[model samples]
Structure formats: structure tokens, C-alpha cells
Target: MFATSSPPPSGPWAGAARTEPQPRAPLRTDLLDTLMRLHREGVAARETRRLVPDAIEHRDLIRWEQRAARELRSMFDEVGWPGLDVVGEVGAEAAWWCVLLCDRLTAFQRDAHGLLQDAGERQAAPARHLAYLDDRLLMHHGEPQQFGTQHQLFADGCVEPYPVDNPALVAERRRSIGLPPTACRTAALRLLSLTRGPPLDDHR
Candidate 1:
């Protein structure tokens, strides 16, 4: 389960944790490979499904997502959100991708926001990730989103922001987290995906 004799060296985010409060998270190489593997599986399922949306059944994609969610729940239950310190930057990113693609566990998904928010306070996780999760939860609950990071793609190949709570404040909130403004209209953090033709609620 271990990577090597010693832990991997930290990356550019070595000093990311707060100086006084919120101590660095200890590394857990045992789970690093597992988290990354799950992320790859999820990405692969999405790519293959996208290519033959209609021909393929959703079983493979759903299975991957369910597995990812289950693994993440186990990790979170044992050690809270795995941040850069715990898994290294790439592994931490892999963890986030797993969380983002998790559609089977709505309760765990909501709980993740709090954990990620706390990690963000410690400078252990990205604010943008939390922003995207928050928007997703809001949309899941049938409420307007905050950062407009969720999107809807139409049959005509046009992409639009999911219903946002306050148009006036969205740009400012997005900028605070280093996201592009509503006017800039960058690709959304989460989309219904191109021509997949499933209702957004289906995943929720």
C-alpha cells in the first residue's frame, strides 16, 4: 500500500496551510493510489459514454460513480477531506474529481461541502471546488445557485448558466474565488454535458 520507503516530496503547494491555525494534514500514501485510480475510472467512463451516448447503457458510468462515492465516504469518515498535504497535489485533485462526479450519495455530497469548506479555511482545499459543490447542491435542491458554476447545454449546442441566485453578486463572488465573472462566461465547473441528453435532475 505504501508508495516507497518515504513519502513523496510536497509540490508547489508545500506551504499552502495556514501558518498558525489549521496545521498541515499528514500524508497517507496508502489511499493516494486508490483515490487516483477511482478518478481515472470515472473519467474513462465519462469519455467512453460520451462517444456513444445512446448505444451505451449507463451501468458502467453509474458503477464507477458509486464506487468513487463509497470510497470517498470511507476516507472522509476516517480522516476528513484528503487535501494536498494528505495526498499530494495530483492526488488531492483526483479526490476532488471523484467528489464532483459522485451522484449516488446525495447526503454524503451535502456533507462534503462542510468538510471542504473547513479545508478551504485551512487553505488545504481550493475555494473554487467548494464554489462548484455549493452550486451543485443548490441546484439539486431546486434552488438558484450561487456562483453560476453549473451549466445547461441545449440541443442547439449553446451553453448557459444554471439559474443563479443573485445576478448582481455572482460576478463579485466568483472573482473572490478567482473564477471568471458572469460576463466572461468561462466553461462551467459542472455541465449537463454535451448531447448526453439526460435531464439535469436525473443525476441529482
Candidate 2:
């Protein structure tokens, strides 16, 4: 769910003409490595759950995830967003995955959004990542936006609480940053639900 290409300038800088590539901050290899490992374990834990919902490993996995998320927050506090250049491409992706999967939003939501926006402006991270951050922020604040990663859980199933703003423009937005169309993503989520069954909980 990450974009590879840089997005056009937006926000206060939207009207500025581009001339050169934005410079990136220094890399933090040590922190990047640690985050990468945590991200890998977290993805593994999630996959295990999807494969076997009642697995006894759930508690330990959840604990590991929580601990890793805390570590990530601490790292962010020290070094900001850990953009692709700072953490390397894979590490940045891992950081995004960790943020997305983390159960609590209080830890990194505010600073992460600002840092991600800065990173996006510098072209150190993909535009899609920034969009995802925006979506997460809007969702956390109970507002409506695009790229529907936010959902609510019920006894029967999960439901998207906000319809995308300006449904007609969604595909264009998605395509601008290399994301698949909204319909494709929705169909994929539907197939995943059918295969993996209802999620055990809403971790978002």
C-alpha cells in the first residue's frame, strides 16, 4: 500500500515550481535494522493469526507487536519519521507497516503525520505513504477521507465508517501515486475476508 514515485507538491508548497530533487537526512542503519526485524515478526504474527485464528500463539504475538510499536515510537521521538533515505527503502516500508498494524494511535499519530508530511515534501518517502498517513489521521479523528483503511468492528463483521470523499476523484488520486484503483483494493479486501474469515479484532 506504499507509493514508489514522488507525488506532486501539495499543501502550502503546492504552487512552487520544482527544480531539483530534495535532499534527504542522514541514515540511521541501527534503528532501521531493528525496525525491520520487528516489522518482519509482526507481519509473521499477523499471517499466523489469519492462517489459524484460534492459535495459542496469539497472546505472545500481540505482546510482541505492542512492545515493538513502543520501540518504534521511541525511535520516532529521537529521529522523526525515518523516511526511506534515513532508514533505507525496505526499512521505511517496515516502519509504515508497523504504524499501520499497531493497536494504539496515541503513541505516534500526531508526530508521525507531521514527520511523514515533511518526508513527502522532501521526496524521501512516497506520496502514497503520505496519503495513508492522512487517511489514518482523518480516521483517528472520526472524519471522512479517501483510501479506506479505517474500519469498525461489530459482532457480525467489520464495516467502513466513512465513505471516501468525492468518490469520482478517488481513482485519479490513487493512480497519481501508483496505488491500484479503489475497486481493486475493495475486491481484494473482500476476497481476503472470505478466505481468512472475520478479523478477530479491530487493531486499527
- Best model number under lDDT: 1
Question: Candidate 1 at residue 188, lDDT?
Answer: 24
- What range of 10 consecutive residues in model 2 has the weakest lDDT sum? 1-10
Tell me which residue pairs clash in candidate 2. none
- Per-residue alpha-carbon lDDT of candidate 2 for residues 64-175, written as tens digits (9 for 90 to 100): 5567757877887788788767886666766765665543443455557777778778877677666766765665555766864443332233433345677788777767
TM-score of each: 0.72, 0.65
For residue 86, model 1's alpha carbon misses the true position, in angstroms, by 0.7
Tens digit of per-residue lDDT, candidate 1, span 1-204: 000000011321223222212334448888888887886776566554232333353566666666777788889988898886687666676776677556455566777778888887877776766777787667666688888766654433345567788789987887777665553222221122422223332332
lDDT (Cα, 0-100) at 60 in candidate 2: 49
Question: Which stretches of model 2 miss by more than 4 angstroms?
Answer: 1-26, 49-62, 149-162, 183-204
**Candidate 1 positional error at 12, Å:** 16
Total clashes in model 1, counting residue pairs 3 or more apart in sequence or in different chains: 0
Q: Which residue pairs in model 1 clash with each other?
A: none
**Alpha-carbon runs more than 4 Å astray in model 1:** 1-26, 49-52, 55-57, 154-158, 182-204
